[model samples]
Target chain A: MAEPGREIPKPTPETQHFWDGCKQGELLLQTCKSCDHTYFPPRPFCPDCGHREVAVVKATGRARLFSYIINHLPTPGFEVPFAIAVVELDEGPRMMANILECEQTPEALVLDMPLEVTFQPVSDDISLPQFKPASQSTGSGSA
Target chain B: MGQKTVAIVGAAETTELGKIPHMSQIQLHADAALNALADAGLTIKDIDGVATAAHNPVELAHYLGITPTWADGTSVGGCSFMLHVRHAMAAIEAGLCTTVLITHGESGRSWVGRHGPSLFPSELQMQFERPFGVSRPPNMFTIPVLRYMKDHDLSVETLAMVSVIQREWAAKNPRASFKDPITVDDVLNSKMIAYPFRLLMCCLVTDGGGALILTKADRAKDFPTKPVYILGSGESVESPMISQMADFTSSRAFKVSGTKAFETSGISHADVDHLMIYDAFAHLPIYGLEDLGFVKPGEAGDFIAERNTAPGGTLPLNTNGGGLSYMHSGMYGMYALQEGVRQMRGIAPAQVEGAEISVVHGVGGMFSASGTIVLTNSE
Candidate 1:
């Protein structure tokens, strides 16, 4: 029998665009047409104003390390002692991801450290959005 | 606030806690229900209303041969029972039901007759969080502690102290899963399940259940046991995703629920002689203390470290050893409520001397929801 793999998200109508954007290497966010409120894990309507009309906009893919834990338990398709983090996007929304390209230790993964989004395709349809320490350069587009 | 309206006449845990491989999940619920009924000197036929979490109220009511007029299956998370108690009070007052039975049971360790994990592929958590390797409560619930520590200058040693003190309380309780005294060094040196959270700092994964019976205050005296009156209760919810919590250092749900309960109860903090803050993890009580307004933000760590919540301290918090040192059967709110009722009745294993009022606060999910209940022995 094949070993179990990490969970892959199946996109609904509301979140298909977000997943599609990830596949194309563009991070997408939803902005309320009436209130200009941008949110994540997309839905058709705006969470703030409940406005059905909304626009899909590309995100800068920049974020900050808000909080995290270095999980020692071996999860499927994940290396043991990996950093499972909650990163606050520069756009003011937060999301969970694995912190990569950095030491999975408290001393190395400082809180509020600048980070940038990176995509790793887990399946043909899903490109999981993850994070790593930001480079010195500013305003680079999504990976 | 003016007068007592509802009272809990009976509260009991399953005949055995920690582990019961023979009993399935629903069987744990039934055992607790039967025990609580026996405690109150009533049978299933007397229950007009039913409420539970993790299982449908309809199944529980029917299995117990009850045809309840009212039923609620509010499964927000671990704190669902606290919300049920709050709702039962309102239901009894509004004449929706004369007597309500609230139950909680989980075969967390045994996993007997429990359903396998449900897969919702398109769910928000599955899409965003799970794919990134965030699974189970330890990783998800402990995610916010690092930020809380950074913002408040809390040391890891203080976090370890939470487990050490709670273990001291556990030593006094004969039923506690762990009774040996442990030191902060012991906690820090314990197996690291997740960063900043050692095995000792996490709650026990046990199989157990508990039930409570509530009715109008006027009819409470007819029960076989002493009645613990419901003075006030509150409940609220926040973002389902732990990552989207408004602030990592505090829970908005806890603040909202605690404030509402305190306001409705019309009782000052000083009036609370005993307290139970659901401690699924060590950092939870810290968050519970500060968010519940018992202490200012950034002070709960210091307050707990100073042993204010320890045995013989000014505030007897988690007199039942809490989830950290006591038994945590997945949905732990029922056990917390049971401890509150015990303290109010002055029969707790580690009873607080001269205890008059007790506040039981609980959190569901990964800071996803909260419920607060205040019980008083006085009318």
Candidate 2:
């Protein structure tokens, strides 16, 4: 089976720092230095105020499952019945990720459940940020 | 606001719908254009304006051997054609063009000479969405379905009824790709493409195209076919990304477009005898109903589940079976617009008796964009 992170996104000048942070086991996000506004899929300017002054800050790596779908369709490097979840970050934005370490079923994956970030190295050059139930303590570091 | 001056004088689909492996995507556009021209009893020379979705107007005009003073290539996804109709109305009113022809064609199933937009790794969709293993439409669309269901207290069975009701309409049309009636159980049991969306709840992958001709109402009598007057039309865009939608329970684009059309047309929902909400997926109509003010929020599920939109119901919906059972040529808006013109002309196969006014609405992406057109047989 292909690994879950089959397609590694090519980092552009704007988003290179985000990928670099993942490789170092840190979840880095951009915040506007002028407005103190944080955002994801990093850009140089603040999306809210269009300020050029921005800073990269380490995230709390805490989030909750906002919504998701159990996809039966086969995707590259993934099996069927996988959960495609939307996680609401503690910093107030949402991002998509695949949930791991839990059975991919409705009974187990509840909405608004606590989740924490776990980086999985899909390639020697890239490590993907994935999520799992926050209750699991071990293997919390880079996998 | 002078909406009654524009009318649809010509409308037709490709020579063969559902599947046409022999014809390329561009060829389908040419065929549908010729058929519409013939239906209007006019030659290509009569067209002064042209619009299309997916295919380029420059190529379409060149292929059809016509020169248009005004051309529109609004590629907003499936609802692109609806916007074309609205733009054609404005162009005609502003004297930019007199007679307009709008065409749509796609070889979704065959992939013959298909050259579509690509989502590169640097694109926002690839950078954020694709990384999450969100495979395709069924996967991406699910971002809203679960939340809508929870907000509305809608059961899975209520959503499946959308397919069952559309199939009921499909059974009456001979050209429908899937005519056999299917029960809600049949829909629920179909292989799940995504949670809350079974195979039946999803639209079909077929190859086809449709065309429309518009002219000033003063010239309506010159056409061979009866005119379907443009009562009102509206179009709007939310966000290109589905995740950025303002509300998961409702489509703001749908609400804005539908409200604008209704206000411009000055027609109440009670007067609409027929309706078509783009049914790319079963949940679309449910969203359309609430957003259009035809039903209250969290009530469209029960409204459809109680047989209000089924055949012989007070308000006929998707009288042509819709994308669920009729045909989805990738961009399904053209088919919906064709059915609207057909009903106004009083010649649809599943014709709604004494149908005077029809409202056709379409969604471009997964609630990313929307357009609404209101039509009437009377001047």
Candidate 3:
């Protein structure tokens, strides 16, 4: 069934493990064995060298806020005045997530602020990797 | 290589813009194509090439009853029509076909028969972007503008000036959707769709389409309309995802394509008499100006704030009011190209008197793709 407000991702064959890892409150990143490069958003092979020999390693869930926007428009799944942020993980990849547990303003959501990943279970099989200020305690417990 | 010569002989927009409840998405394409054909004094049988974005070339060709020898359907986004013009020029130069008709139409506001591209479950956008609650273009595009503001010291007031300058041009255009003068405070205080972008700063939700007829420059005089010669053209795509942009401050695709167009045209910044940088959002023109080498990085805001791009200014930009005040039917490149043709032909409603050369640049996704075209009236 489709979620009401926000768009949900249906995990594919190549992406099932990543979603499963999220449900367990873990962040998985794909690393190329040949080039030793780490990448995000889950792919089948190494995007760096086109190598089939790839491995999924657990990330440290550590990142720094790169950029963000406080979207005031009313979206279906999310409330208005939410901070949609792009954070560069310490492992050398970037991804988008909601900067929860912080004021959705330019002052509070400072750039390069330390961040850590937290999972929000949207469905039985899906758990989204959301982020919050690293100074704050981990909010959501592992399912 | 010698100058590759191609000319746009005919250009026309859909009959009604802004609110056209009568036409479907495909019908807009047909409407523009037929209008262009009539403008060029040619029949459907005369066109040997067909190219379009948003709709299938096969569908448009069949609908117009033209069996083109060459067809190009390069849909990169709003700038897709610019790529179509480039491809059509190359095809005509290579003797693949002649008399190419490039069309664009979209029910962006009405959403009638608006069949969007189908992204599979495994697609990058579906897997990554959608999951993050990135609902639409407004939210997705603001991700970069906010960063740009921080890096460039661009205040919200400076950004609002972009719309103010464009509205100044729109006031001169009789057909402009929003001709009334708008102030910077008006723009800043409007409903905030996203951070730093207000309702006035965003492109208007409009329903319309436009078409262009192109042929070799040598044969351009044979057509009824004055040929707007294609001096140079370039198109490029940096990434499909906005988050994966090369940088937040600038668009790599805009730089790549704009540099190529300038180099091919062999014209300096001084030679440009007019300009049309697609203003889907206020920040786009800022990026377009900087990336296209017209202005230095972080200077576009002040350039507009100083009233340099308004009518009678040294550089007349978005003389058709741009997407901000003009009709924006989703794919805005076609309208940009049409304005270039109008200026070159000296027939623009907001005519920049004695204008000789015009540069039309466009952005596809949120700085994800770009296409640039250089047009001139001189042989």
Specify the highest-TM-score model's number. Answer: 1
lDDT by residue (tens digit), candidate 1, B198-271: 99999999999999999999988888887899998889999778888889999999999999999989999988
Report the error of model 3 at residue B232, Å.
Answer: 1.0
Question: Fnat for model 2?
Answer: 0.61
Better of 1 and 3 by lDDT: 1
The DockQ-based CAPRI class assigned to model 2 is medium
Which candidate has the highest lDDT of all?
1
Chain B TM-score, candidates in order: 0.98, 0.97, 0.97
| Model 3 global lDDT (CA atoms, 0 to 1) | 0.86
Residue A52 Cα positional deviation in candidate 1, in Å, after optimal superposition: 2.0
lDDT of 1 by residue, A83-115 (tens): 999988888888898888888898999888889
Q: Residue B57 of model 3: what lDDT?
A: 90
Best by DockQ: 1
lDDT of 2 at B6: 92
Cα deviation at B129, candidate 2, in Å, is 0.9
- The clash numbers for all candidates, in the given order, read 0, 0, 2
Q: What CA RMSD would you report for each candidate?
A: 2.3, 3.1, 3.1
